[model samples]
Target: MKVAVHPDRRPSHEAEVIAFSYHRLALDLARHLGRDVNNWYCYAVWASKAVSENLDLSPGSCFLGDVAARLNVPVWLRRPFRRVFLALLGPSYPLALALANRAIFLEMGSLAAELWDADDDYLIRVDETGDFVRRPEFLSALLAPAEEEFLDAVVRLFTKARNATGPERAEFVLGANIALVAYEQQRAQRLLELVLNRPPRWLLQGSWRWLWCALRRRPFHRLAIYTAPHAELAWPARKAERWWVRFYTSRLMVMRTPVGRIQLGRPLPPPKGAAPETVWAPIQDLEVRELVDRFLPSDFDRATAGVGNWLSFDDRMRFIVAYFRMYANVPELFDPPFTSDKLDELEAEMDEGHVPEPYQEWLQKENARRAAAGRGVRGLIARQRYRSPFRSDPDAAALAGFDLTGCVHRRTLRPEAGPEALLCCGIDGELCGDAGGRCGRQA
Candidate 1:
C-alpha cells in the first residue's frame, strides 16, 4: 500500500493567535533558560498543534478563556463578556495577556518537545482519531531519547558557523540550523563543508545574490557567525558599508529635476490627485482622523515636515508606542479593531528596536482610522479584497488580504505548496476573521 502525503493544512485563525501567544511564552522561556532554540515559527507550529489536541478549542476561544482566568472573570459570563472584561482589565490587557499565556505554556513543560518533534501530517492523523488513541505510540517514536543531545549539537553547530567565513557561510548556517532541529547534526556539518568546498549549481543563478543579501541583512545575522572577521572596522566604516549596500539594493527612481533627495524634517507634498483612499479602513473615517489629530502636536504636520517625508524606524516605533500608551485605557480605541498577534508583533518590534518602518506606518494609520470609526485595532495588516493564487473559488478569491511580507498579497500559495509557503499564513488568516470552513483548502 502506498502511504499518502497530503499538503499541510492551514491552522484556523484562533489556532494562530493561540500559537502566537504561546510563541511569546516560548521566547521568554528560551531567554530565561539561556538556551539557543529554534525560531518563533517552530514554536508556533508546536503550540498550535498542542492547543488543537489538548483543548479541542480554537485559539481565539483559548485566548479569551486565558484572559478571563487571568482577570478572575468567570468563563460562564455571556453576552457582554468581552465588553465587561475589557472594562475590567482596561489598558492592562496586553501585559495581562502576556502573563496568562506564559502561565499556560509553562504548564506544558517537556510535552512541548513532543509537539515540536511531531510533523503536521502525524498531528493531523492523531487529531482525526478523536480520542488521540495513537498519540502515545506516535509521540514515543517521534521524540527520540537523544533529543536533548541533538539540541545541544545544534547550538554548537550554530556557534561554529558564526566563526566560519566563506562564500557558502550563510547557506551552511541555515542548513545547520534546520538540520539541528531535525536531529541531523552530521548531515548539517556535511552541508556546511559541501557549501564551503563547492558552490551549489543553483547558486550560479542570479537568485543566490538576493539570498545572500537577505541572509546578511537579517536581524540574527551576527548571531549566526561566531566571530566578526572585520571586527577592526570602526562604527562609521560599518555604517558607511551598510548605507552603500542599502543604496545598491534600493529601487532607483529617475527624476528630471536636479532636486536633492528630500531632506529630513520636510514633508513631501501630498500628491496632486485625490489622496488615494487611505490604505486603512479606519483612516477613512473622519471622526478617527479628528481624534488622532487631537493627540498630535498643533503643528504636527509642520513639525514632522522638518523630520522628512518618511519617519525613521525609531521615530515610527515611538509614535506607535505613544499612540498605544495614550489609548490603552480606552477599549473603544485599543481593543476590538486589532488582533492580539499584530499587537504582539508590534510590541516585539518595539522591544527589539527593529520595527520595519513601512509596516509601522501602516499600523499607525490603520489604528488611527479604526479609532475614528469607533472600531478597535484588529490586526497588523488591514483587510483588502484579493485573489488567493492557491484557490479558484470565488469566495476564497475575494478573501481579505494581509500584508505579511510587508508587500501585501503580491505573492501567494500554490496548490502544490504547503502552508509554509506563506510566512504569515496562520496569523493573517486568524486576523482576517474568516470562519474555518470558508478558507478551507479544496482538494
Candidate 2:
C-alpha cells in the first residue's frame, strides 16, 4: 500500500520554512542570546548608582545628569571605552567580575577576557591550592576539550565584536553573553543527564526541559532508586550495573547474608490464590513537582534581591519554605496577618482605658449568654478582641522558628522595651540573626 508522509514524522522537514534563510536558526538564536547581554541604558542605572555613592566627587543634586553625560558612550563603543575608563579609574574588569554573580552584576576577576576584547595574553594571578580557579585559561584547561574550544571561541567572538560597538554597547553585549553562557551551561548539563538516563515521558514536553535536553549530551533517569516500595527498579539494567553500580556492589552485597537479606525480615509465605497488586503510584505526585517548580524560582529571585547571591543558606531556606507552602498550605509560611484597619483599631483601643459602659455591659451579657448555652465564651471573646492578621505570641514565635518556652520573656515584654532589655532573653540568636548575615553565617 502507498503511504502518505506525516508532517510530524520527519525531523528534517520543518512545519514552516523562511524564504532566503541562509542562516541556521540554532546558531542565530545562540548568537542573539549572547549579544544582547549588556544593554547600555541598564548599565547607566548601575553607573548612576555608582556615581551617586561617591560623595567626595559631590556632583550635587544634578549628579545623575552629570554621571549620565560623563558615561554616555554609544552602546556599541561602550565595551572598549569602559575598559579604558575602568583601567584609568584603577578598578580593572577582573576586579568587577570577581564580585558580581547575579543576573545583573558580575565580579571583576570572574569576568572572561573575551568580555573586554583585550589581548589573549592577559593573565589572572592564582595562589596556592588552585581550588578557586578564576582565569578563563585555567577553566578552559580544566573543562572537556569540546567545551573549552566552544567557550574560548565564544569569548574570542565577543571580544572581536566588542571593538565594533561603543562602551555602552560592549557592556550590554557582555551582560547578555554572561546571562546566555550561564543559561547554556545549565542547559547542557541538564540535557546530558536526560539523554544518558532516559527521563519520564512527561518531562520532555516542557519548554525548559526541552531546552535542557537540546543542550545536554545525555539524558538522566527521572525517577530515583528510592521511588516507592517496588516499582520494578527503573534502570537501563545491565549497562547501569556495569557503569554506575559496580563501584559500590561490595557494600550492597554485605546486606545479602546467608541468614536473610537485611531488609527481608523473614519472607512471607506465598498465597495460593491471591494476585499481586499491579498498579504503581509515584510517591511524589506531578502536582507537587509542578507547584514546587513554580514557587522555588520566585523564592530564589526574592533571595537574590535581598542578598547578592542566591546560594546563601537563608536564601535556600526561603526557597524551602516557599516549596513547603505550596506542598502543604500552612499559616506559618506567611507573615503576621497585616491589615491597616486592625492596626488602627489596636492604636485606638490602646488610647482608651475602657469601652463605654453600654458596650462593656453588652459584651458581658453576650459572654454570659454563650456560657449559659455551654458554648465556650473565652474563644468568642478572644476572636472579637483582636484585629485580623494580628498574630498572637505563639503564632509569632512559630513564624520566627522559636519554641513558645524560649520566647516566654518576649510575651511579657512590650514593643516599647529597650533594645538591650528585649535582647536580654537571647531571642537575637533564636531569631534568624541579622537577616542578611544569617544565611552567610550558615554558608
Candidate 3:
C-alpha cells in the first residue's frame, strides 16, 4: 500500500500519496522482463517535453509514453484484465509505483497527437470569426472569486519553492500542477516570473509563432526541452541549454519540475542599460532540429558517451546494416522489406563508393548462400537491439513548428492575423503565436 515513502531525509507526513494504473505491471516488467531493462532516474522520468497542452502524471507517461501494444482493448475484456492484474499485484503496488521511473524516448510531440486532441477548454477560445479569449480571462470568469486569490497562492507557492532546499523544491511546485524551472545558467526564475509579467493575452499567445511561420524565422529552435546536464554539447548548431516551462493538466498530482533560479520557457531579460541584442539574439537563433538532436535528451538524462550507435537501422529490411549503409544504397534489401525510424540519423561523412573487390566478392557469395536458403535479406535481422534510455522528443518538424505552423494552435492562428507583424490565434487555449509588430512584417 505504501510504495515510496519520501526519502528518509524528509518526514513522511509531508509527502504525497497517490496511485498509478499499471504500477504492478511496470514493477513486474522491471523486475522480471529483462535484467537489463534500462534504469532511468526518477527526476528525468518526471520531466516533460513540448506539446504542453495535455500532460498527465501517470506511470511511464513521459514524452516517450506507452509504446508496448495494448492487446486487450475490447470493452468486455478490459475490466477483467485490469482486475486480474490488480488482484495479482495488489499488495506490492507501492513498489511498482516507486520503481516505475524509466520511459523510452520516441518522439518530439504527441505520437497520437491527432488522437490526443479534445475540446477541454472551458474558459478560452477563438471562434470562427477570428477573435480570441485567453486562459486568464476564462479562468477569471469561471473562478471569479478565487482567480485572483489562486494567482496570489501560486506566487506564494513559487516563493516557498524558491526558498526550499533542492530536495524539497518539488513540494512547492506540484501543489499547483506547475513545472516551474530556470533557463540556462539561472536566467529566469520560475514560470510565473515571466508568465505573470506578461499580459494574459500574450502569456497564452506570443508573436514568435507567426514570425517563424510567415517569414521562416528561426524562433527558439534547438534549445533543450528537458534537463540534460549529462548531454555533451558536441552537435553543430546545438548549443547547450537546460531550461523549460510547460503548462499542462495533471490529475490529482503535482510534478517535481521546479529547481532553483530557473525560468521555464520565457527568454532572458535585458539588464539595465545593457545591449538589448543579448536577449533577443538567443531567441532568433533558429536552426533546424535533427535526428541526432533526438538522441541527445534521454529519459534517463545520462551522458552521451556510452550511447554509441554506429550502425543504421535499415527500416526496409528490419535489419542492422553496415554503419555507413542506408536503404538507398542497399539494393538487396528490396522487395517488401521494412525500416526503422530509430536510426533515422543523417550521417556527416557518408559511407559511399565501392566496396573492395575481395569484400564485394565475399558479400556476393554470402548473398548467394543466404538466397539459396529461405532466411531473409542483406543485413542481420536484429533480434535484440540495445534498449537505450532516451527522452521522447517532438519530431524535427514539431521543434520547427513556428516556421511551419507547429500545431493546431499555430495553424489556426496564421490566417487570422494581418499580413504585417500583427499576429492572432483562433484556437481555444491557443493564442496568436505571432510576433505582432515586433517583426514589423505582415501577411
Model 2, 1-443: lDDT tens digits are: 00011111111111001100111222233243333332222222222223223211122323223333445656566556544533232211111111111111111112231233343322121111233222222221111111111223234434444444443333323323332233223222322222222222222222245346446833422122211112243444434423432222212111111122221112121223322221011113232232233223433334222221122223333333232222121112121122456435433432332211111112223333444445367656555553211122122112122111111111011212221222122121123334221222210
User: Candidate 2: deviation at residue 122, Å?
Assistant: 6.3
Decoy 3 TM-score against native: 0.16
> Which candidate number maximizes TM-score?
1
Model 2, 256: alpha-carbon shift in Å? 50
For model 1, what is the error of residue 247's alpha carbon versus the real structure, in angstroms, after optimal superposition?
Answer: 51
Model 2 alpha-carbon miss at residue 130, Å = 14
Model 2 residue 182 distance off true place after TM-score fit, in angstroms: 6.7
lDDT of 1 by residue, 257-362 (tens): 1112222223322322313232111332232233233223434343233321111222322232222222222212111122666656534532332222211112
Alpha-carbon lDDT, every model:
0.28, 0.25, 0.21
Among all windows of 10 consecutive residues in model 1, the one with the lowest summed lDDT is 1-10
Error of 3 at 421 (Å): 21
Q: Estimate TM-scores for all models.
A: 0.19, 0.17, 0.16
Q: Residue 315, candidate 1: how far off, in angstroms?
A: 48
